[model samples]
Target chain A: MVVVSLNNVTKKIGSKTIIDNLSFDVHAGEVFGFLGPNGAGKTTTIRMLVGLMKITSGDIFIDGHSVKANFEEAISKVGAIVENPEMYKFMSGYDNLKHYARMVKGVTLERIDEVAELVGLQNRMKEKVKTYSLGMRQRLGIAQALLHRPKVLILDEPTNGLDPAGIREIRDYLKRLAREEDMAVIVSSHLLSEMEMMCDRIGIIQNGRMIDVQLVNDMVNGGNVSYVISAKPIDQAFNVLQHAFEGINVKMTKQHLHVEGESVDVPKLVKRLVENQCDIYEVKQVNQSLEEKFLEITSEKGGIA
Target chain B: MGLLANEWIKIFKRKSSYIMIGILAIIVLVAAIGMTFINNQGTETGDNGNWKTALEAENKDLKEELKSTPGPYKKEVERVIAENEYRITHEMPRVTSYNVWTFMNGMMGLVDIVALFTIIIAAGIVASEFSWGTIKLLLIRPINRAKILLSKYITVLLYALFMLAILFVLSFILGAAFFGFEQNQPHLAYLDGQIVERAQIPFLLSQYALSSVGLLIFTTMAFMISAAFRNSSLAIGLSIFLLLVGSIVTSIIAGFFDWAKYLLFANTNLLPYFGTGTPMVEGMTLAFSLIVLLVYFIIFLVVAFWAFVKRDVAA
Candidate 1:
């Protein structure tokens, strides 16, 4: 089932359109990544889905319940962490969970403990949130969002402030949650590589519009192939590769030439480079990283990523 | 119901709330101790003073009447003796646990501490969400916005109740310890309109209790003010300012207009069961105060709910 659906959702703040007729679906058990740059309407869309903000136009549905008409019922099925995870900092982590647990239905004390364990905060659950590190706070946020056993989890930039290790832990944990727990997760991030690693499908949003919705494999074109040609006198190396490989694009960085072409084109280029007395030190095909893809999409609309 | 329980937990969980309770306790203790010392210091030390001379003259007149009585003057003599004994021992007019409470209640105006505390505590009852950046978290909880607001208002009332209960207990304990619970034998005869002898002490206590209900209404009005204004400083500041200025405004307005009775704070203490034992005016009844408060309470609650649910959590 589609756990969440936005049909042409549009929202405007004053004269600026923050979310422009965006549409997407989060299926059950799928880790969906909402990829966008800053001000690309990722938070706005999530806020609308969670009923924090009204939709200027269009409709949002959570498990087939209209967010506008049946907001309470719709929002009950959703647990979200928007922007930053804010909680009662004076309360212990366990107490914070307990406090939020009461707001949700059928959330038992046992479930609270379970969620704490799931977020890897079981050891420090009794400690005050003020004493928690930023990573622990992020985990606690996830735990709070997951406390009610929500069918859909919407987190915006859940891993933004974390160190690399913290990021990996959250990524692995969320992936496990989606696969094992059968939750449809909508994770928003500016870092496309993280999303690519964790998300099964991604919705690329830019300037308030959902530019594209595709599987991770399709977004990368099964990780689009690129060739890096390194030959002495790099200016000549670029001319040699471009002439030999027609219809292929080339961009020159300081020490090497980056060429986007077929994987098979590398050997042909290497042979030509040696023949032209261009000292060929490296001829390698590089896979386009998710960061590169994200930049390509968001940069067109002037997004700051 | 679970949500309401959650709201209650929030009140107990925050450290600031406990601080508020502690402040209330301190205020009550200080007031009780200070009043006791002042009262003791002001009493006449010597027996044969000016007050005694006047009393002796009155006693002589009453004795003359006893001599005129041909039948049993024994009862009259006993009554006069009791009166003189009471006069000599410092009957301590208006001094019971309930009377101290009334006196302390009046002194609420003199000291702005309780009013300050009420504003500080009650103002954040609703508006704290904005300051703490918790509005979005609270709104996404799936409960109705009306319930959210009602829950907050209920929490503030609970705080008020808890504070008042603490003050009541502390005052009584301190008052009894210092003043030595003197049976509170009613001495003021014909209080307001009713006839009274030395046997209506329990009745007086009950009347004071009824009168304190008026004070509770005043607290609720402050709660509504806090809820209406979402900023703690503004909420607390405005409510206290209005409270301090309200009586002055009432008297000033009354100087020009008569409809000032409808103003909420004017007749908040509806049962002035203190001085003269009756309401200043015939119409300033407890029921009238309650009705006006209910109207204001409903309006304030409606506005709080509407603002909470509809206002964007932009922060």
Candidate 2:
């Protein structure tokens, strides 16, 4: 089932289109990463989905309930931490949980305890939130969000302030949540590697526009190839091979030829280069990373999103 | 209901709430004790004689004045004499716990100061959420914005009630401890150039409690200001400034302009039970002040509710 859906959702702040014609679906049991750079409207989109903001001209539905028309019911199914999670600094973590739990129906004390344990905050739940480290506070935030067993968890930069271990913990917890709880999790971040490991699929956004949405594997799969071919009489061989494959772009660095093209013509091109008195020594396809794909897509639009 | 409770817990968690109540209680306690001291000092004539002699001197002056005045004022003079005679015969002029109660009752017009604090406290309750970057966690709680705002208002009102109740209890307890608990002595008041006294002290004190309802309404106005401004300093400063300016301007107009009484603050003091003091203007009445205040109160409430529920939290 689709847990949350936005159709043609547009948000404008004065004349600036913050989220223009933005549409996406969060299906049940998937860790959907919302990847974008700063000022890319990632937070704005998440805010709209959580009902903290209104869409300029479109429908946002949570479990089939319209966010605009039935905000209370629609929001009840969504657990989100927008921008940052804030708790009363003076109150203990347990008290904060108790206080937030009241807003969510049927959230028993046992459920609060369970969530605290889930977030690994069982030992420090009695301590004031002001004393908590950023990472601990983040875990507590996640715990608070899950107190009501919400079907959809929308987190914007949930690991923004966490240390490496904290990020790993949150990433692992989110993965477990999607798998064990069957929840649809939408996490936004600027970190590509983190998203690559945590998200099953990613939607790349830039300049308040979603440039592309693709599976992590599909995005990084075979998009780049680095080849090291040795050709003797280097200067003359480079000229001959360059003229034979007019469409192919080659870069000669040190002792290697890095050729990036369709794999289908690579063998033929290798034969052509050899016929031109080019003695090719070594050739290999370099693995492309999600970071490279993210950079390529985001840089095309100057990283506005 | 759950939201309201949560809001209440939030309000109580703040240090300002306790500090406000503590200050109010101290003020009420000091005022009660001060009145008792004044009452005691006035009566302990010692070698110069006692309270009875002072009362006799006052009575003598009134008698002398009555005798000197001519026929046209005779009826008024006779009425004053009758009331004075009753007070003297019944020992109603003596100060006791009733006197402190009566004194506080007379000063009830100043209770609007609570409204100023109410605004200051209530404004920060929600505004601090944004200012301190806590609103993000609050908004993600799967609750409607309207409910959140409503809960805030409820929390503010509870704070106001707690402050008032603290004041009330402190005044009564301190008054009784310092001033002997004498119920037979009448509640003393200087009205219409005569000392009018009530038969029941507790009943008069209870009647004075009605003024607090007006105070509650004023505090509600403060809450609205706080909600609209969303900054504690701005809300508190502007509300207090406006309130002080409102009173000063009303007084100035009443003295110079006939329409001054029409200003809501001019006649806010509702202690016209015996109808002694002149209102700021000719037509000014408690009912008229109440109507004008209510209108402004409703407008403030509407704006506060709307802004709190609709405005964005940028922090």
Candidate 3:
């Protein structure tokens, strides 16, 4: 089900367009990643989605309510953290959650405690947010956004300032929330690898316009899968694979042979290398990362990469 | 209501608010202690025992001066003569010792301190959110912009009232503790050739309310500046600067321009109209001042709500 939909939403600041005719839908039980480089209007789009900024033209709907006409109803179904989780440093972590919970109805103290545990901050909830590290702050922010049990959770640059472990923790936590709560999560990030592990589907935006939207699976291994073979005498292995698998795209890199083919053909190429008396030291399947896919998509559109 | 509680809690969580209240309380205690020490020096007037005869002689001399000089100071002299005659007839002593009522009256000036603290809160209540980058999360709540802004504005006014209560109640308690309620007389006023007598506590309370009219206006101005600009320093500085000098500037302008009657400070002190005193400008009536104040109050609120509701949360 489409939990949130942006129908041709446009945002213009003065004469310059910040987000132009952006359109997409986020479904429940799925993590949708908004990917783009810096200054690609990713943050602006998130701002409009949560009603922080106005849409110059077009409309956005959240849970069947129009965001422009019925803002309170639409936004009530969403919990978002735009930019950094800049909370009141003087207030304790629990107090910050309570503060946000007070803004919405039906949030009891138990719910506040439950969310604190969900974010793994229950032990430190009474401590001031100033004492929290960036990771703890991010978790507290997520905990705040979840207090109201919103149907949609939108986080812009959720991993902007976290170490690898913290980033992984957030990624796994978000994925679990999306699956267990059946909530639609929208995460925007410039890091391709993070999105690959976190998002189920992604929409790539560039220069205030969406360039591509696809399932993460199709985006990574939709067309061709590459295999990297590091063997003795790389040129011999390269020629053996090129001759055995006719019309296959094979390249001879330094000390390795890169072969582009299906998984079924990778083993066949490896068998032929051994039959031709070439040493098969190692053979590994290489999945094209979302970063390369992004470059490929941009280059296909003949735009600036 | 929830929003208001949230804002109220947010304010008290900071140390600055406690500091403000502490400073105000200390000022009152120090001022009272200073007065107590000065009065302990036994600076009693020699004429206190025969003040009726002294006032009678002063009235005779004032009547003589009234016959000789006729100028702008004439009305002041006439007012003094009328008050002296009324005092002598009523047997009210001019040189009374310090009492609880007098202490309460003296503490009325401390309403300005309450105003300063209130303005500090008003200035930061809205602007600090933006500066901290918390406005992004704040604006994303289920509440609409108008409701949120209204809650914040109401919180500021409530804070002003709370500070005023602290000042009044604390001063009253302190005054009663140090200076007993001995020989407290009714407040006397010379109004239109008549001596009006008012009970002391009611008179003091009304004086406090009248003084706080200026506080309320200055706090609202600070709030408006805070919402329009995301800089608490600018709001606090500008509002405080105006609060200190607004009336003085209005008086300077009133000397040449009659339209100065419409200035906010000219109308803030409603005590003149309530009690027996001349208006800041000659032609300003009670109704006229109230209307001017109402207009400025509305203008400040309208600008505040407009800026808060209409502007994009870019910061």
User: Which stretches in model 1 have alpha-carbon errors above 4 Å?
Assistant: A13-16, A222-224, A231-246, A249-258, A262-264, A268-280, A299-305, B39-116, B187-229, B272-291
Put down candidate 1 lDDT per residue, B255-286, tens digits, no spaces.
56657768876666644533333332345666
**Model 3 in CAPRI terms: which quality?**
high
Relative to the unseen true structure, what is the C-alpha lDDT of residue A294 in candidate 1, on a scale of 0 to 100?
72
Backbone clashes in model 2, listed as residue pairs? A40-A305, A207-A305, A230-A281
Clashing pairs in 1: none
* Residues forming the 10-long window of minimal summed lDDT in candidate 1 chain B: B273-282
TM-score of 1: 0.81
True contacts kept of each: 0.67, 0.64, 0.91
Evaluation by TM-score, superior candidate among 1 and 2? 2
**CA error at residue A36 for candidate 1, angstroms:** 2.6
Model 3 clash pairs? none
Best of the candidates, DockQ: 3
What's the iRMSD of model 2?
A: 1.9
Ranking by TM-score: 3, 2, 1
DockQ of each: 0.50, 0.56, 0.83
Instruction: Tell me the chain A TM-score of model 1.
Output: 0.84
